[model samples]
Target: MVTGGAGFIGANLVRALGEVPQVSEVVIVDDLSTGLLDNLDGLPARLFQGSVLDPDLLDDALAGAASVVHLGALGSVPRSIDQPLQSHHANATGTLMVLEAARRHGVRQVILSSSSSVYGANPVLPRQEGLRPVPVSPYAVSKLAAEAYAVAYSACYGLPVLPFRFFNVFGPRQAAHHAYAAVLPRFVTAALAGEPLRVHGDGRQTRDFTFVGSVTSVIVDAIVRRVTTTDVVNLAFGARISLLDLIAELEDILSRPLPVVHEPPRPGDVRDSQADCSRLRELFPSVRPVALRSGLEQTVSWMSGHVLTGH
Candidate 1:
């Protein structure tokens, strides 16, 4: 069972899971609040259209499922800052509900989609799992709380859970027009249209931008291998790039300079973030890191098509 299966990452993951020979069925549970039906086009999966907050709906979705991937959440730092209660309800309470349903359904494993935001503004270069979390936003707090619940469920209820902390993931199918859209998609869309790209805080903030394919590959591997552990692993390339450098790379891909507009950094925004992927390598020794430039090229190609088609 895949929560948020029609979302950006979830939709990509659903496609990846279809290639697994051992997998028989894929169940998708999404409320369409942030997920789009177009993202699930041509996908073979049982769709359960409802929020995870609905216990009855979740129970129905969990029926006949072997494992659960909890990716559904109200994701966005600025949005979470604007609506703290809704973020907590969706990210924190919704995760607890999923775990409870998984436990009730006798699911063998539950994989959680966590975030690097839990590290907050700590000056740590590459964040490790051992560092104390200093969450700065409601979104971070909700993810941290969800991670705690996952660990507790594993220890107290014997439920096998593995939480993966993903860095700035970007790739095809990511929404480009949403108010809370990620930086890559927004920049790609603007650049394709010959519009000025908005840069917050001088565009010097650094992030360990990860590709979506890498994220889904690790997820499918975990599900197919049935990894049994309560460890939290960082899934990233471990390479940090400033926003200015990212823009330069995009310009190089497009063969044209993009106009830039500087703006003040929004609240709850962190300065720099990078992941210590040693634990991830230790857990999944076979996984290979995808280069940022390669991922950007693929993303730009897809975005160009989308722009031509007016999607």
Candidate 2:
């Protein structure tokens, strides 16, 4: 079962999981709040259109399910700042409900998607799982609370759960039209339209952007092998690059220069983010890392055909 399966990363993961030979059926539970049902079009997966916070809804969805990938959460730091309680209810409380449901249903595996934003305000280079989380935003705090519940559940009960701390994950199906869109999708949209890529800060903030394909691949592998741990793992290779460098790379890929406009940094934004992937390597040594340029190419190709086609 995949929560938020109609969402950006969730949609990509649902498609990948559907393709696997070992997986027989895919069940998805999403409230269509942040997720778009169109993203799941033509995919061979069952959809339960409701939030994970509802016990009856979650119970009905998790019946006889082998695994649950909890990806349903309210995203965006600024949005969380504006609506802190809503974010906490959807993200933090929602995760607890999912965990409880998984435990009740006897689900063999549960993969929770936590965020790197939990490391906000921490000045540690190449963020490790051990770093003290000093969350700056309501979203970050909610994610921390979510992951903490997952960890606590695993410790209290012998529940097989892996709470992964995701870095800047991006690729196909990622929303670009929204006001709170990720930088890569936003940049791609602007560049394709011959508009200036509006950047926050001086455009030197670095991030370890992991492709959605790689993330799904690892997740599928984990589900197949029933890989579980009490600790959280960072899900990114050490491919950190600044926003300016990313723009330059995008220009190279498109074979045309793109314009840029600088804006003051927004509240609850991090300066730089990089992952310490040693733990990830230890867990999934067989998984190959996707290069940034190649990932960008895939994203551009998908966006060119899908997002750029029509209204």
What pairs collide in candidate 2?
Answer: none
Cα misplacement distance, residue 159 of candidate 2 (Å): 1.3
Winning candidate number (lDDT): 2
Question: Candidate 1 at residue 223, lDDT?
Answer: 90
Error of 1 at 131 (Å): 0.9
Q: What is candidate 2's lDDT per residue for 1-311, written digit by digit as tens?
A: 99999999999999999889989999999999889988989999999999899999999889889999999998889889999999999999999999999999889899999999999989999899999998999999999999999889888987889999989999988988887888899999999889999999999999999999999989999998989998999999888999999999999999999999999999999999999999999999999978899999999998988887842
| Residue 258 of model 1, lDDT score | 93
Residue-wise C-alpha lDDT for candidate 1, range 1-311, written one tens digit per residue: 99999999999999999989999999999999999998899998989999999999999999988899999999999999999999999999999999999999999999998899999978888999888889999999999999999999999999999998889999999888789998889999999888999999989999999999999989888998998678788889689999999999999999999999999899898999999998888888899867899999999998899854766
TM-score of 1: 0.98
> For model 1, what is the alpha-carbon lDDT of residue 90?
96
Please give me the total number of clashing residue pairs in predicted model 1: 0
What TM-score against the true fold does each predicted structure earn? 0.98, 0.98
Looking at model 2, residue 152 earns an lDDT score of: 92
